[model samples]
Target: MTYKAVFFDIDGTLVNEEKEIPQDTIEAIAQLKESGIDVFIATGRAPYYFQHYAKPLGIDSFVSFNGSYVVYKGKVVHEHPIPEKTLELLESTALANNHPIVMQGAEAGYANYPTTRSIRSLPNRSMICVLRCPATEAATGRRRRCTKRCCIAKLTRNRCTRRPKLRSVT
Candidate 1:
């Protein structure tokens, strides 16, 4: 297929379970840029999370917060915020379940509570915030992963390069 632009998913497709982006992948992106192809990352992560990332890859644009937000050349091209009514409903649901709720928007990621209660109660249990589950499990009847680690490993393996770049220093 002939294409003028290429889009990549970030979490599993680019960065692995350890959240490491591969040097080869970065080099590959650089090469693509050198060839005059447009490269972009599509992710559930907020645009700010990509601040330290996109520059090195020569990414021309981004679709963040699961496409609810878009950025080009450090400027917002589009933004879709969750309505307050929806937020209220979700919060109420979560409160009933004694669980935590997280909201991921174009600008940032936020949790109702940063503690483990919120972390443990999430159905899909993604690090990135996306309103995919009901506030309470009873309300949604969602089936969560029986095993988190193995599932995470499988998920990361499927999305990222086998050998990704690793750095020790923060």
Candidate 2:
């Protein structure tokens, strides 16, 4: 059996702790493309976070935001944004538990509450910029297409702060 396409994640799987692709991996990707296999990026990161890696890695198709958005050859083929009602539920849940969350739209993103050290340290370690916006801004904003909801679970004030844990509403 043969596969027609291959997908790669951006963070640890594709880039190292230094956030740089290894030379061997780059060569492998080149070989895969040269052999007629279609390569694509599948990442939970917002597209802009990994924008610089695209052309250098020779990838045009992507399934970003944990499959909420999909693009092929620079054209968006699919988009499944979370609804506003769900965002409300998530926001309330995170607030009650004192957990922080970062909601990301196609063009912009921000933290729902005041950030902790861990949250603030994330962007510096990588390219994921956590924009500082007013909390009144909706997670599923009507003005922008919301594609990613990243729940950040951390220990706050010696208590384990859980986040907006997802549950299937069957």
Candidate 3:
């Protein structure tokens, strides 16, 4: 059996723990493309972060944001944004839990904390909106700080209540 397309996860599959892509992986991808097989990336990370690696690796298609977004040949094929109500609930829960929240969007990301190396690694750091909690709202805006109650399990349970509808682009 032959596969027409191949998808690889960025973090550990294509890139190592040290964040370096092995030369063999790059060569293999090139060989696949030369042989008429399509190579793509499927990652939970925002698209911009992996863009620099895409072209060099001969990847033109992607499934990003844990499959919430999809792009093919520089064109967006699908997208899905979390509902406003759900986002609000998440923000409130995070605030109550004192957990720092980082919201990833299609083009950029938003964080409720200072810019860290991890956050800075995004393609466009300037696009990331820094949200300030009520305590620091005076200096920023109407953001709230995430407290200790912002457990991942609780947040996951809350978000699972409603699935975001996928928006297809022709």
Top candidate when judged by TM-score against the true structure: 3
Instruction: Supply the TM-score for candidate 3.
Output: 0.64
Evaluated against the true structure, the overall lDDT of model 2 is 0.61
- Tens digits of per-residue lDDT, candidate 2, 37-149, equal 99999987667567778778869898888877888988889887666578667666766786766666543344545445634554433312222221213443433322233
Candidate 3 lDDT by residue in tens digits, 67-124: 8889887788888877656676776676578666766665555555535785566665
lDDT of 1 by residue, 51-100 (tens): 55676676759887677777776677887766545555665577569676
lDDT comparison, 1 vs 3, better candidate? 3
Ranked by lDDT from best down, the candidates are 3, 2, 1
Q: How well does model 1 score by local distance difference test? A: 0.54
- Candidate 1 C-alpha error for residue 116, in Å: 5.8
For model 1, state the Cα shift of residue 115 in Å: 1.3
Query: Between candidates 1 and 3, which one is better according to TM-score?
Result: 3
Q: TM-score order of candidates, best first?
A: 3, 2, 1
Residue-level lDDT for 26 in candidate 2: 96
Residue 42, model 3: Cα distance from true site in angstroms: 1.2
